[model samples]
Every structure is written in structure tokens, then in C-alpha cells.
Target: MVASVEEVSSSLVREYLSRKGLKRTIACMDEEHPRTEASINNRSQLRETLHIEDLYRKNKVDKSPFKTLLEIIVKHHIEQFVSLEPNDTKADEITSAVVCGKQSKIRPETEEECPSQPSYRSLMCEQDGLSSHDHIASANDSDCQKSQPLIPFLENNVSFGQRKPDINTMKPEDTQRSRSNRIRRGMMAGPVPQESTKKRQSRRAEVSQPLLSKEEENKQAQERLLFTGIHKKNLERSLTGISIADCGGGKPSGRVQSENSNGKVEQNMQKTRNVKTEPNLSDLNVSELVLDDIDDDDLREFSKVSLQRTVAKCQYTGRPMDKQTATELKAVLLGSSLNYFSVEWRNQSFTFSEIPELSYGIVQRKGGPCGVLASIQAFVLKKLLFENTEISYTGLQRLRPSNATRRQCLVLAMAEILWRAGEEKQATVAIKSGKSHFTPSDHFRSEEVLEKIMCFTVDNLKDLQFILEQHIEQFDSGMLGCILLTISAVLSRSVEKVREDMDVPSTTLIGAHGYCTQELVNLLLCGRAASNVFDNDMELDSGNGNMMLLKGIKSHCDVGLLSLFEHYNICKVGAYLKTPSYPIWVVCSESHFSVLFGLQRELLTNEDKGLEFDLYYYDGLANQQEEIRLTISIGNLSQSFQEVDTDLIPPLELCIRTRWKDAFVSWNDTEPLL
Candidate 1:
């Protein structure tokens, strides 16, 4: 065996404390506490006593390891006189150090003659309940030899690793084994009883407390039952003879055993006293008693073994998977998209039938600067091509680009449109190159050029107002939010007409860019521009043109004609409800554009009632869905991606709604929108 071992590291102690949520105790360890400081300084004492090094490598303490470690350390301090075979010199040294501070003994006549350190006395008093006076008496008393301190046998001098005795002693091997068994059983004896003649006389003189009457006992039992919420009878039965013995086999000092003058009781007591010196192996029933019974002496040895076995079985044998669990686990393991045979159970037998796999129509990605339009096309294509109950991650994966950086979403959308246009090679080329065949100027009535033509300038605002006045057929129209939608539809139709005149079979795509949306609305209402040429570059997809367009439109629009609602400030929904002329609302959030159409059945002058109307939302880039109902309330609109009702709609419609919700959506009305 090694003479020295490493102490338990501070890291292990920290991890143990953290797992137990006792971080506050670590705060004290850092502070100045004498016992802790002494323990830190006296590393050798702790190392020798608890064998702290082995605590981590082999944690033998089954319950409350920290508590067991503390008990071991405390027991080591008190083991000098409490040993089964005491060495006189060691006992004297412990007594002298504790009571007289290196002096041999403390005189009874002059008790105050010997001084002791306050820290040492306080530490001892805190660790054990023994006062300095009690320590001196315990050290000097002859009864100490018979009555030892209440510490577990394992914590004393006897180590589990001690070498076994030679077999050729005085007895045969069988006899030696029996004698060793008797000694082990004797060591499992209950706590030492009072033995002094003077103590016995004092005990006889002391009055014993009277036992509770039957009625009072019943009342107390009922109170306990009420407190624990257990039934009255069950509580009473459990309390009758419930003896919670320590796992160490030591009997609790306060436990009361019934008086037994039987031969068995006498024989057992006699055996405990004499067995340590000269064990009688024949008397003790080693076969009947289990070795594990030494840890818990209260329960029958056989029952404890059965209990341990039952617990071990429960820990090892987990519940078997049922039909539902098996099906779900199988679905998850092999991708959910993979087909599996459905098993139906009838009576004792089950029939398995193969479920056919679903096929998907491949939608290609189109090229050029139509990513937004491509996304919308992909969304529509998915819904039109596939038949599914709800929007699935697998279905959406086909349309969306896996890589976010430099996405060819527009190319995919263009490909889908060109595929519909019957130009498969061009579509393939568009997807591969990720570039548009038609330049910014090639398409005549193309919606792509609408933003370039409707250049938002102070000079253009008057033309925008003129254009709007002409297009908004009825003043104070119920179709206020439909302005953007109407412009998009009109532009789309005009582009299709031009494509028809040119004999171009492919349908020209339209996208709802934030910058172009406001200006397009202006151009559609203001009438045709003199020329498509603009002050700014025609290719203004990624720029500050949208912001400038918004500013220019806001400046020219009639008072109360337009209102803005930030998705984040949705709590200010009340302000938008009261706009005169049923304002054309534009919810400018993130980089997306959405129109709020006032859907009031009848005109109302009252602001309170006016605010209660439903607002129809038009998001051209809204995936597969056509329109959204933005129902306004006092504080919020009824909307959430999770709460969205996509049940009746196609998978593509649901995908669009999901994408919208994923973008600039608010979780709670009180919190800001994402």
C-alpha cells in the first residue's frame, strides 16, 4: 500500500457544492472560519482520517457523501479513548492535549489552574457537543473503557483493507472462520449501555416520564396524519413500532426497546460483551443472519436483501416500448419522410400494410434580380404541386435555399416562371447563371422598371397626387389599403399585355420591393410617365430609394390620407383606427411592405367604433397565400405564426404565412416585434 496520496482537489469540492446548490457555503470557506482554517492547515490529519483521496476515486458513502465524510473526520478526533483495545499512552496524550493543554491531568480541586485555547474549545464544542469539562471527565473516567463514544466502527482504527490473520493459529480453518463471524456479529451490537454503580443508583432515584394515554395517543396520531396528509389508520399503524435505525447499525440513543427477560435477549447481550475478547462461533447463527444486516440492524436481514434486490431490478429494467412509442421512435430515427408499413392490431394479431411514399414536383430556381419574386413563385409552386395536410419542414426545404449567403432564390423563382413560360433552356440557363435574361431596360411595361419611372422627388409628388386622385375612383373610398395591391395588379396586367404584343410567351414577374411599392402606387394613379428614364439608376433594387420614396409620398399625400404602423409599436394600433377618409395604411416594418385595407361595412364618424373595423392586409411577397386579415384591436392585432390558422389552406399558403410570421413578427403585443 502507498504511504501517501493526493488530497481531494478544490475543483472537485466546488463541483460537488455547485451540484448541491450550496454556493453560499463556498463563500464561508473563502472567509476566515477557524475550524475550516485549522482543517486546511492540518491537511495530514484530514488525509489520514477520512482518506479524502479515495473519496473521489471510490465514493463508498451511499447516502449523503458529504455528511459521511464529516462524520468520519469527527469520529477520528474522538477515537483515542473509544478504541476497543486502548493503548494507554495514546489515550493519555489525547486527554492531556484536550483538557490540560499538554499537562498530564486536570486536578479536580483546582479546576481553573489549567488554561485552554478558546478557538480549540469552540471548534470541539461545535464539532461535537462535548464541553471542555465533559472532555476532562470522559478522559479520566474508568467507565470510558466500557462505554465508548457513539461513532461507527468503520470510522475507527479498523480499516476495511487490513490483512487477514494467519489460518494456522490455534483453531482449524472452519473454526477460525466461525470465530471471525462471531466477532463481526458481536461488533454489530447496539450502543453501550450504562454500567457504573453510582450511575445505576442515580438512575433509580430519577423519576421516569409517564407514557401517553390511549386517547391522547390517538389524538396525537390523528394530528400527525393531518399534517402528513396520510390516512388516520395508516399513520397510526406506521407509528406503532416504526424504528428508523441508522444505516451504520448503531441504534439511536432515544429509541425505546420493549423489556425482554427472555433467554434470547440475555444471550445476545452476553454475547456482545464477551464476543470481542473470546468469540463463541457456535452460539451465533451465521446462516440465519445476513452479513448486510450489520448496516441496518432494525430490519430482518433477509428482508433487507430482498429490498436491495428489488431496487436494483427496478433500476436496470426499464419499461418496454408500446405500439405508439415504437411507431414514433421509428418515424424519428429513419427520417419522417421515409415510408413505413402501418401496423393495425385486431384482437391478438396485427396486419402490416405498406404506405406509399409521396412524390414532389421539382420547382427550379430562376435567375436575375428577382429573388423576392422567385420566393413568391417557389411558394406558389410548392402549394400547387404538392398535396399535404400541414406545412412540413421537409416540404419547405425544397423551396428555401439551405445556404443563406448569396442565395439564388430569385433564380429559382425565375426558373419556375420560365418553366411555365415554356422556355425550359432559358430557365435552366437562368438557374445556372443566377442572372436575369431581360436587363432593367429590355421589358417595356415590366414591373421591374416601375420604380425607375416613378422616381420619388419633390417635383414628382404633384404628379403622384394627380395620379392618385385620378385612380382612387371614389374619395374617402372603403378600398384604402388596396392602393398598393391595385397598383401591383394593374402593373402586372400592363406588363403581360406588352409581353403579348411583343409575342414573348413568358409571363413577366412582379415583386413588392419596399422602395418601389410607394412609387408604383403613385405612378398607377398619376397616369403614364412621359418616358421611362429616371434621375436615379434603373437598377436600384438594393439602395436607399425605398426610404426616399416613402418620404416623398408622405410629403405629397393629403392630410389623413396615409398612416404608418410599425410592427414593433403595434400597441399604438388605436391611432391608425381613427384616421379620417379611411386612410391607406402601410405597415412599414423591417424591409417588407404590407398594405392595411379598411374593411368597414358602413362609414362611421365615431373614432371608437371606427377603430373596431377589420383591416385586410395585402403582402405581394406573401408566399402562397393571397391576402391576410390584420384585425385591429385596442392594443394589438390578432396575429401570430404559431396561432395562424393554416388548416384549410394548401401547404404553400401555410408556408408563406409561416415565413411572414418568421419575419418581423411579434410574440406578445406588450413585447416588441422581431
Candidate 2:
């Protein structure tokens, strides 16, 4: 008969405790066979002992102190027994008995049986105080019939020691056989001898139970018609569908057999039944049906590939549309496709134009100008206007220049016509004639005229400055005065005031005034203007206007100009005189005297000459002192002053003193020289 479940449970616990090296304290009630030294004899007895020990250790034993010990035993078992070779005889037998209920063979009776039991007379002879073994032997003799079930008793309670069967008195051959059986059982049990057959059976039973119900099966089948995920869901869906036999075996009528499809035959049948009642199948959107099936990566790849293919197709057809043309086509297609299918492509279409506009109506929706097209139009406009081509006013009006793009083209054409006229040396003739070919008034201004003017002013400043500087020598003092005065006038005006009247940076007006003034200066200094002052044809106003010009020059003088004079002091004479015929030597000497006298007067009067002067003087003196200390820095300065003659320096000094004395005499006679 099989052992009771309680006995098996206890046996398993004892086995576990033994493996964990836990002490077994349960006293067996049937001490009739005095407890011998515990040793396992048979494979069943060995397994039963191990199982009971294991259960005892797991439940009754405290784990806090022996947690690390339990982990070591668990790891050993996993390594030794869990990973045991399938072909290993002992492992195979143990696994089969646990997993499949196959029992190992018992040892033969003759080799296993004890010889004549140890006699009570012998125990008495030995006088060993009637040891537990003797006590068990005496009980066995008296209750031999009842004690025949000792195997059951051992299986129920014995745990964690070698089995003793009156070993000192057992026959030699029986002992040898018993020992061999014990060894075989130990090898078969492997490392985790407490891993019981019943527990393994229960675990396998729990794992094998079906997870889905009839309704769940049907729902899963419907889902399969839609999509299939990996592993768990795929297996569930596969099991839910119908078999070919259930579908009457004519190739399963509703099934779409794709090799890539993971949905099983059973799931497809369930899907077919659910879908049968749904109407308007043709109108059903494929995306709506299978969106869940698509992975994010797959969707991205699809979009990229579709766009690339579309671009390639457009290119290959030779009627290749530009981006604007493509956008227009896509918009038209989207509108038509939406109306035809009663489905909006606003969400479906990829192109920018196909996207919905703000709810502001179609009239408000117009495409903006492209940058490159605007540039090209501007270039074309410049060419048409200035190239001396015969263009009618009617033709110009019909050009339909509504946007910045068309306006730019017209401007460019006008510029080009003017440029060509100049390049051909016909600019003067064209300007004088008034009716000379190309006319481009339409290209004159933009909507943002003030902005354009500001940009123009900023763009041309460097060039304007360069031109002024280059011809600066040609300008007479009168013209230079006018230029400086004009600049000063503009600078003196508040920028806000200028903006109120001019609608541009004050810099623009300042620049234009400077340019015109500089040009006038250039003409006056070069003596290029007509000489007769009152003559209608002459442009010069030589009387009081010239005196006004001198006053403007004096007013314009500032620290900056003075520093320039000091930096290129000799160059100042070269700039003012312009020609050798003018008494440059006399003027330069006088100017140098005036500068020195002015400095001395400022020092005497305790007035500020300016920070520029102070910095120049301080830096120069400091540098001289450093040179005196080091000498190397003054190497190049020796050659720079070579033009100054040592003999002429005395006469220069006398002349400076005379000028200062004359100035002082004139001043002292008038109002006490204050």
C-alpha cells in the first residue's frame, strides 16, 4: 500500500532538513527497534528519509541563521542535479521516478536480508547495558509480526542519519549487498534528494492548465483577424481559431493564408464568424483595421520609402515638377480624393500643401513667395529696364507685378538696362534725351521703402567713405568745410526728429549731406568750378559765402582733427596746400607755431585742451622715458626726424617767439587780454 499523504509530507520535510544540515529532533514513538545509527539501505528508504528531512528543514527550522547555508545547498543542487545529463543513468532514474512515477528496482532478498538477529543471550553476554540496538532486537523478537512494517515506520519518521539494521550482528553478505544498495540510492538521489515526485507532479499540473475560456477564445480569434503579437498572445490566438475539419475542408473558404501571418487556423475561423455580420466591407479603411499591427519603426520606414519612391517616380517621368508644381498637384489630388471617397486626406496625406489651412476660408489662403524666385525676378527686372530696349507703358502695366517677387524682377530689369546704357557709354545721352528707350518707374520703390533705404545706407557706407578719403586731397578748404559742417548739422539733429520727418536712420541723411558737401569741396579745392562769381553759368559764390565757408571750417574743428594734425603734422600741410604753387612752407611753419602757442596759452590759462591732447602728450613723454631707460625702442625714431635741420631749429624757434609776442601785444592792448 502507498504511504499516507501526511507520512509523505513529513518524510519530504525530514529529507529537506537533512540536506540543509539541520538537526532532526522528532522522537519516533515506535522505539521498539531501538534506534540504530541511521543509515539508508534501499533507494525508496533513502529518498523517503531525504524528503522528510527536507520538509522539516523548510518548515520547522529557522531560516535567519541558515539562509546562506540554504542558498549554498540550493545552488549545489541546481548545478549538480538540475543540470544533470539526460543520459546519466542515476539521474535519469531519479528524474523518471519523480516526473513519471517509475520506481527503481529493489536489491535481491538474500544480499539485503539480515542473518540471524543478534541474540538476547549474546547482548546479556556482552553486558553493554542493553544498548538501543539490543533493545530494538529484543522488541523485534517479541513483536516480529507487528514490526514487519518497519519500512513504513522509517518512511514516516526516520531522518538524517545512517540506517542501522542490527549491523554488528548482520550476515556479511547481507551487509555488503545493503551497502551497495545504499550507495546506488545515494548516487541516484543526486544533490537535491528532497525534490519530491508529488511536488513535481503538482507543478506540472498547474503549468499545463489552459488559460483561455470559450468566450476568451472567440474574442482572441477576432483579434487575430486584426493582428498578432509575439509569443504569448500569438500562442493564445493560434489556439482560439478553428481547424480545417470544422471549416468543411474546402481550403477554409474565408481564410487568407499568408506565410508571414502568425495567426493560426483556429483563430481565423473565429474571425470569419465575427466578421460575417459586418457590412460595407469595401469602404472599410485598411489603416483602421491594421494600425495596431504596425510598429513605430515600421511606420517611419514606410513613410520614408513612400516619399523616396514618389520623388524617384517624378524624376524618372521627365515631366519632373518643381516643389511648387508638386505641391499644387498634391493639393488638387487631396481635395478630389477626399470628395470621391468621402474620406479626408488631411490626416492621411504627407505633403505640406495637402494639409488643412486655418479655418479662415480659401480666399485668405494664398502661397507666399519663394526666396530664389524673388531673386531671379529682381535680376530680370534690372536687365529689362536699363538695357535701352523699346518697352511700352502698356506692356509694363500688363506685367502683373503683384508680389515682392514680380516687383523685384522689374527692378532688376530696370537696373540692367541702366547698367548696359552706362557700359555702352550712352548713359549721358540716355539721361538727357528723356525719351531714350527703357523706362522703369515701376521698379523705383518697395512697400517697405524706409527699410530699403536704411539697408542701402548701411550697405554703401564703406564704399562712400573710401571714395571720400581717396579724393580728399583734391577738395579745397571751402569744400572740406562744407562737408564737415553738413555732417555736424545732421549729427546735431535728434534721431527722433529725423525719424519723424525722414522715415529712415539719421545716418542716411548725414551720409548724403556729407557726400554732396565733399563733392562740392573737391570741386572748390581743385579750382574746377567756373570762375565768374556773378555769371549765370558759374556755380561758385565767392564773396560772403566764402567767408561763411571759413566760419564753418573753424566751427567744425574738434579734438579728433587736432590729434590727426599732431599724428601726420607734415601731411596736414600737404592736404591743405594741394599744390607746390601755394606757399606751403610758410603756411606749415605758421601752423606749427600756432599749435605750440595754443598749447602754451591753454597751460597758462589753466584750460582743458582736451583728453586727446592730454593722452598724446602723456603717452609720448612716458614712451620717451622708457626709451631713455632701454634705448632699443628709439632705434627707428632717429630716422623719422631726419628732415628737421639742427641749424634751422634756431630760426624756427625765433619765428615761433615772434608770432607769440605779436599775438600777446595785440591781445594785451584789447580788454586786458582776457
Candidate 3:
């Protein structure tokens, strides 16, 4: 052979090494590298050839341990995934760098220009990030000619459901008032009176369609949710109890399937390691039965869009509570909760009944949303205590819980809360709604269209919710910020007190810090968080204004307890929060919140010395076939042995004491399940 390319290159390198008198370098080169050739000379091309750009990106922002492995896996998949793609000469190189199912979503438009460097997103990756890379599930490259984005790729194969994006995208808006693509479906106030009949007619004509017949629709819903077989029977037998669902035309509640969905709107119910389901609004809202709370007709049907509904069951009976009955009980409970636990004892003995008058549903222990769930419990209690929303209709009050509107309700409530919490800048930003109350799509679009702001009054509820969700999506801080917002809506504590007691310093958006604090829980239930102690409800901030808010456990709201840890301090949770009026308690473990409840109202009001009741558990995770069941005893139990402080007790036993002074919990020979 004349002279191969490698020989010639090696000879040239040897000559150069001899000229520089680097014999050691020449020897090292000869020993280390048998071949060196560059088909592509530029840095970009070389980086592509090596396929180690992800490694460089990892070095730029990585602080966590698993990020190293993540980068490697992503690199391998990207290389394998990209190579099999069909040639697309017309497509522009994807300008946006996206890591799907991550804390940080796509980078802002500014970061698109820096392709050589990985500048967007934080190092944080979910523990399940590996499984989420559905692009790798393929046996061959030909399987992945479908799409490039990881999220969309997963959405293609394993669809949980149609859920609102957890990570809310943020962008700047020029105007405070939103006018285009807006409709005012007043949730709290019911429907806003039309400013002009002519306009309402025009819009209704454009979007109007025939309403689904209730009988036929519910029939379809039943078949879809349950099968007429032994599985359905088993499911029914295992149900722990009932929950108060919205009075939405008596439709049954259903759980989300992890596989593909059969409905138009799919609710993505993801189960965490702890089995807490990330909430996508449990079919219906916990709207009070109070018909007077809003205009009945307006609340009945404000929007043309029909969303899926979850059934509500009785906490005590495990039977489906009718809409009318649930509404009545909810109204009564709402009336009682407004008292804020300020009730005079009548020596009332709780009369136990098989008929579950008090309905309760179990929402799963979604880890990131405990704070929000806690606040929502308090918020509903607060509304019942204060707002005049009790159901007056004798007949089944047909309505939509309007989860979308409920989000609006929460956002508005949060805006007020943020203001009270001394987050003025964020509150200000959150309160600015476009001219119209409803912006179905392109909620934050920059382009403005001049149209009638029919109802001139601004509703910051929708806008505030978007901001909070966006922030939650941005930092993946979970529901702590949402909890603060909900707490602000119902909490009676003064702004000054809240500012002083808040664990995280005030900012535009409140920080969740990933879990619930004693202070935050206090604020959620007792309308105050003056102390961190989870002991007895006591007098706090006696001085003046809202500052004199109640903290700690209230005298009578005890409904028993369930905690994951056996050694948890029962005194760490305040009385009212541990035992809520909804006949439900949030079972918190590892920062996740599941629900524990009883069907009887007497759990809170029964003053009998030897009180006993059955308690049921529900976690929206839908992992279990039915709700878990347990039993509780109070004031009358004889201990097998005298227990000391150092001697650990089951969390269920000790936590009940937090509510009842001398209570005993019984598993009834059943194994303890937290």
C-alpha cells in the first residue's frame, strides 16, 4: 500500500513532535492513540458526533445526585431517538429545549438562541423521570417517527386523562383588563345579568348545542364507571364510606384510569410512591348545598362546556348520598362550621344511624398538595360558617360544581389572601383580570381585542389562580402557596399576625417549602396560626383586630386520626384541624395528605363518655379497591397497661387523644393501615 491516511497523519504528528523535541509526548501519543481522523472539523459537529453535549449541560446546572444518571440516560435516548427520525429537510431545528414532566418546563424564547449551551431549566428531576421517557419504550427506532417532545410522546401512548397542565406557563401581559375571549360566568354571585341582550344572544348562538338528557347520560356514565359484575360488587363492598360531592344532577363519581381514558376530558391521576394522587379536581367540587349562595338558575347552567363529574358518597354508610340529602346536610354543616367551633354544649349525645346523613369523600394523599387540601377543608368550613349558601331546594338541586369556576373561586380567594399575607406586589399582579371574567383559551395572550367588557366589574379570581398555578408549576413547590391563598380567604387572623408567624418570609408568591407547617395548619383550621404547638386549642393574641385569632385545637371538632408514622406527636396537630366539621381528617405522612373520616355527625358533637364510632379512609390515589376501615373509642377504654411518654403508641391511638382528652383507638383485631 502507498500510504494509508492514519499512517500519514501519524508520520506528520511524529515529525512535529520531533521538531518540538517532545519525545515523551510522541511516545504517549503512539501508545495511547492508534487512530485519529476528523470527518467533521467544527466544534458543533464534533460535539454531535460524540453525543456528550448532555454531559456538558449537566455540569452547567447540576446540583442534585441523580442528575448525572439522568443526563446520561437522556443523552443515550436522544441519540438513539434522533437517529431513527425520518429526514425532514423543511423543519427548523427545534429552537426550544424541553425536559418533559419536570419542574421547569420550556425555557423562555431568549434561551433558544444559545444552542451550544444548555441554559434553561434547573437540575431538579423527578424520581420517576426515567419511566417518563416514553420515547425509549420502543423496541426499534422505527416506532418513534411520531414526535420529538418527551411529554407529547408519553401523551401519545399512555394517556392518564385530559388534565390542566400542572406546570403553568408564565409570560408578561401589557394590560390589566382582559377583554378578548372572555365570558363572565359568575360563580359566587351566580350569573351576571346581561349588559345587552343582543350580545348574549349572538354569543349563545355561536356556541350553543343541545343539552344531554340526564337519564340517558347518567346511564352511559354508570356503564362507563362501573361494570354490572362481581368486580362492581366487590368495589361496592369495599367502599369505606361517603363524601359530599357537588349536587350535579345525581351523577355517580368515578376514578381516573392510569391507562387511556374513554371521556373527552381526561383527568390525569398520577400516583406517587406514597399513593397520593395529584389532584385534577375530583370530578366535582365541594360546593356547599346552599342554593342561596348563588342564583340557582345561573349556577345550574352558566357554561355550555360539560366536564366529567365524580360521585359523592356517605362517609358513614358507604352508600351514595342523594343530591338533595347531601345538599341539606352540607348546608347544615356549613351553617355549623361558620360558628368557628364557638358552640355551646347541650350535653347532646350523638345518635348513631345506619343512614349516613353526613356524607364524606376521601381525596387521595397527593404529596405536593396537602397544604392546599388542608386550606380547602378550612375554606369550605369558613364559607359554611359565614357565606349564606345553604341549599333551599327540596328537589335535587341540579348544578355543576364548575371546577374551572372553582379554580376561579380559589384564585380570587388567594388574591385576597396574598393581600392579607402582605404579598402586595404579587397580589397586585394576580388581581389583574382581562376585561372579561372567562378567558377559555390563550388566557394570557398579548393581543387584545376591543369588545364589550359586558360586566365592567373586575374579577381577579381567574387571573390569580393562573398566577399561583404558574408559580407552583414553575418551582414545583407543590400546594403550600395555594394553602396560604385559601387560608387568606377564610382565615380571620390579622395581616400583621400572619406576616409575623409565616414560616417563609413574604414574597409575591408564598413558598410551600414542600410541606405543611404547624403554623400553616393552625391558620387553615382555627383561622389563626399564632403558635406552632399542635396541642389544645387555646386563647392566642388576645389583644385586638383579626390578630386575636384562635390557634390550636378547638373543644369539639374531634373525629379521630390516622397518621403514617406510629410515633407522631398527637399534640403536633391542632384540635380543629385534626377533627374538621366535614367529619373528615387529612392523614398526613411524608408530607402527603390522605383523608380519614366517619359517617356520623356525632363524632364531633357526641359528648357521651364511652363514645365509639367506625372510621373509614379514602385516598384519591384510587390504588385501593375500596376505602380502608377502622374503629375509634373515647373516654371509656381501660388500658391494658399504663403507657408512659417514652413508650410509643400507634399514631391512630395518640392522635385521637389530641381531639378527645382520654380516647382509645381500636383496630378491632384488624391490622393497622395508615
Candidate 4:
């Protein structure tokens, strides 16, 4: 095999052996070579290099602990801390030399040298005994500096005195004539001479022109000085009682009175001057000086006097205490706030009336979708289009369904209309597609669709209502969806059919924007005596909500035989009901609504009747048919509740039944329904 190692001199091998404290290896070799002093020194250096190479190859080289650390730090600092300017080629050379552990010959150009550096010429001088390499570097540096000049220190080049000129100074022509000039010119007399229009216009133009030339400027300055001087001189002359022509050129005099004149005697002179020579006081404009000594009482008296006078300026035909006009004015003032009563009087006695005329009135307002329905019923239903609309008109009364069966007839008619309008199918698609407003086909015009549906109207509206109620129980009828349903019912069925279905004479299609509860209640009283008057009238002597609920209940009860209470308060079950209204009552909880019918009326009226109530609840959305028996004796009734002869039974305490639990209720809990 070929030897992998290089041969060492015998002397070097001997030195290595001596350093290792081993026996001299040269004694074992043949002593044929002569050793001179020069040869020994050469052999010693060879031994040192050989030993170093061996140690390095064997991975046993001795080194400072900080040497490798220092080299790594220097390389990192060169790459990280050094910032290279744009096109700084010298920076690249320096970085490369440092990284390679070689000296960098690249020197910064003279111009590029730090401002704090020593002489610039010495850095590039070839006469400094530098070699050819240094000369070449200097030449390259000069070329670089010539190509890229040093940047000036911008921070030290701040300007000190220069400033922007003002706008007024730059354009003196834009300056407006001073206010004093106008006052001074106003003193000039008019109608002195009538020059030709052309000459007058030319003079005006010259006057209005800007003061541009130096001569014009000097002229204006002199005029200003003359104005001040003449005004002072004229003012002094006026104090001396000189004539106007004697002072300045028969110019008009100013209104400024001379302070040097007598305290009271000047007034006599002023009157004579105005009458004989001066113009009218109006033209002179002394209005600002004409003041009256008016204190607070004087102002009051003036206002009183003005108010006492009416359309005609003539005095009232009566004395102050008995003036009919004054009485009339007082009455008008009181009538303006007739709707609002004074509440500031302490210890004031309030009158109580058995009738509801003095009771706190509740103005009915229709709100939300319910309001929309009410508006259509109260306004749209009475139009000529629906004037003749009734059950008889629909040709459904021929079947002779009893009054009890009218609701069934109306429901059937509504269902037939929906079926004809194709809303049922559209609604199903909307539900499946998870969209609320999508109506699938536009095959029929809205009115035509309604008319067609009416043609197919079912005779029994109640049965259809029940089915719809059941369907809605399991589904969410969006607000719009529910409103549309009500609208379709009105369009397809006659007013009589709707009346029967809703158990109220007036059926409404209400919504969030259109109608309110007050309007809805008013609509429910349609065809009744109460319906003719405004729902807000205190003279009507009935609470709007109670009146509406009573009117609806009267349609289903035998209340026509009894006298209408005519005067009633709100939230009272029997306030307007003269007969037994226990058979049906509308219940509302929040936005959800239901109707309750008494299942055991005779039991309720029994002399031994307990505090229990048996009601049949009909929820439109839930389609629930529940017999809710609740104890209402624990619920408190108002102390003011009265048992009138017209009332059928004691007022039923309002209560809410959620699931199977019963709780007392407030009329405020429900909105439009209440």
C-alpha cells in the first residue's frame, strides 16, 4: 500500500520525541549526515511546523479560548452593524475581506472620508511610500469620489432670515376703501352739477381704479392726511359757531354735536337750524338718539295695551271689568288647553262620576301589523268596492248556516281563497327554501288572484280557520306572512264572513307601520253606536280598549237585550258588558295571542261557585285546545270595581297561563290585543 503520511527528517522526529519526554529517536538512526549550524536551525524550524501540522491533523491543536469566539463576533459585526450606502462598492470589499480573514485594501475616497478624519490628501497620497497596489487603490478611490460626491450636511444649512410676504402687502390693489372714507364722502353735497353720463361714468371708473402707481399712492396718502386735517379744522370751526361754507366747501354737516356749546341753550339753536336750513331729521338719521325712559313696568303696560286691542282698533263696547271682548279673549285662552288640565293646584278636589266621563281616558292607537289590519278594515273595507260585500253577496248564506256556524263559513271561504291564490303552495316552498319573502310564481295579478280565490271560496270559514291555526302551530309565520294571510282573508271573504270568523263585526289587516291598537279597537266597534265617534273623545264615556273588546264579545252574546253601559273604563272585563260575556274573552301575552271561551258558564254562576275558572283556550299559532282550570280568587281586583245592574257577573281577574302554570297578569304585558 502507498504511504498516506509524509516522511519527516530524522532531526525533527528526534525533537518531537524529546518534547514528548521519550528516548532520543536520532540515536537509533545511522549517523551518516553531517549537521552544520545552519542545518540545525533549519531543522528546528521544520520540526516546529511539522509538530503544528500533526497537532492540527490530530484535532489536538492548542488555542486561546477566546480566539474562535473573537473571529465569529467580528464576522457577525461586519455583516450586521455595517450599513452600506447606495452604490457603496468599497463597503462590499471591506465586508468580504473581514469575512475571509484577509486585510481589506479598499480605502474610502477623499470626499467619502468622515468629517472628523485627519487630512484628506494624506489618505490618497502615493508619495507616502505606498506600493503599486496602494497606488491602484488610490486611483480607484478617486474615481469613485468623482462619480459619487459627498452629501452636504442638511441639518446645518437652516435658513435664518427669509420669510413669506403677507397677502395684503403683495397686492395693495386688492385693498378696500376704508370705512372712514365713506363717512367723509357722505358729507359731500349732492345735485351740485349734472355732468354728461359718459363723463360721470369715466370719473367714477377712475375713482374706483386701484392705487397702483407711486403717484396714485402718494395722492391717496395726501388725501387721507387732508381728510383728517380738514375734519379736525371743521370740527373746531363748528365749535366756534362758524357757517358750513366758511369751514370746508358747503359740505353737509355731521350729526356730532359740539361739546363746547351751552348745556341747554344749544337745543334752541338746533330746532331753528332744522326748520330753516338743515334737512329732515329722518334724512339726517338721528333715530339712534331718540330714546324713551322705559322701565320694566312701562314695557308691561305697553304690551298690555297692545294685547287689549283686537282686530278692530275701536275701544271695546264695554267697561274694563265687563268687556265682552276681554271675556271672549279669556275664554279663548282657556279653550286652547282644554285637553290638558292644570295639575299645579295643591289640595284641589277632584270630581268623581258614576259614569266614565271623568275617568282617565286611554286613546287607542294601532301599532305594528295589527294596526295595518285595523286601517284596512276601518278605511278600505268601507270603500265602494266592498260596500256591498257580505255573506249574502258571496252566495254562501243560502245554506242557512246558523249564527254559530257563521265562523265555520268564513274560515272555509278564506281557505278556498288561499287555495285559489296559490299562497299555500308558495308558503310551503318558502319554508322549505328557508326564505321568508320569496313568492314563487307571478302567474296571476294580485287582484285577479284574490277575485279567483273568492270564486272558489269555501262556505265554512271556521273549519278552514281551525286548519290554518293548526298548521301555524308548528311553524313560524313570519310577520309579513301572517299579515298577508289576514289580507287574503279580507280580499277573498266578505266583510260579514270576516266578521263571523273573527267573532267581531270589523275585521282588520294591520301591520308595523300602518295601524295602531287604538285604531284597531275603534275598527272592532264598526256598525256599533260607539264606532261613529272618535276613539279618543272623553265624551264617548268608554275606554277605547274595553269598548273594542266588549263590542267584539257582544256579537257572540245576547247583549243586545241589555242596555249598553255606554260609560266604561279600560281593562275591566264587564265595564261595557251588560250581559254574560264569560263565554269568550281575548287573551294576549306579549306578541303571542289566544282566545278563551267559558266551558262551564252555568257552573261559574252557581251560588256555591268556588274561586276556580274553567276556560277553553284556542291558540291560533299553537292550535292548542286546552281546558285550563285556574284559581283566580288569589289575584287581587281593583277597589274601584263596581257591580252595576247591567253587569252580568263579577269581573274576571286577568291571569296568564303558561304551559300548566298560572300567574296574575297585567294589561300592559300585551300590546295591540289589550
Name the top lDDT candidate.
Answer: 3
- Cα lDDT of all candidates, in order? 0.29, 0.27, 0.37, 0.30
TM-score winner, 2 or 4: 4
Which candidate wins on TM-score? 3
lDDT of 3 by residue, 536-625 (tens): 534455465434433444343322233444335433554444555556665655555555555555667786787778765544333444
Ranking by TM-score: 3, 4, 1, 2
Q: What's the C-alpha lDDT at position 418 in model 4? A: 45
TM-score of each: 0.17, 0.13, 0.30, 0.21
Instruction: Count clashes in each candidate, considering only residues at least 3 apart in sequence or on different chains.
Output: 13, 54, 35, 34
Error of 3 at 193 (Å): 36
Model 2 residue 267 lDDT score: 20
What residue runs in model 1 are displaced by over 4 Å at the alpha carbon?
Answer: 1-132, 136-332, 336-673
Q: Regarding TM-score, does 1 or 2 come out ahead?
A: 1
Query: Candidate 3: what lDDT?
Result: 0.37
What C-alpha lDDT does candidate 2 achieve relative to the native structure? 0.27
Model 1: weakest 10-residue lDDT segment is 350-359
Report model 3's TM-score to 2 decimal places.
Answer: 0.30
Cα lDDT of model 2 by residue, 1-674, tens digit: 55455554443444344344342132131112111123221224644543535633553355552333334356556667877777666775575344423354443445333333423333331332333343344334344323332333333333445454665678989767755654444321123255465455334323422566656545545564455422223222233332223335344533342333443223232222222222222222223333323445547744654444343333211122123322222222122111111111111110011101100001101111111112122233233323324333232221212122222333332222222312222111000111212221332221121111111011122322332232222221111212222221222222233233221222222112111221112112222111111112213356786621211111111111121232233322222221112111121122221111111112222322221111001011011121011111111223434455635333333222221221111121212100
Local lDDT at 50 for model 4: 43
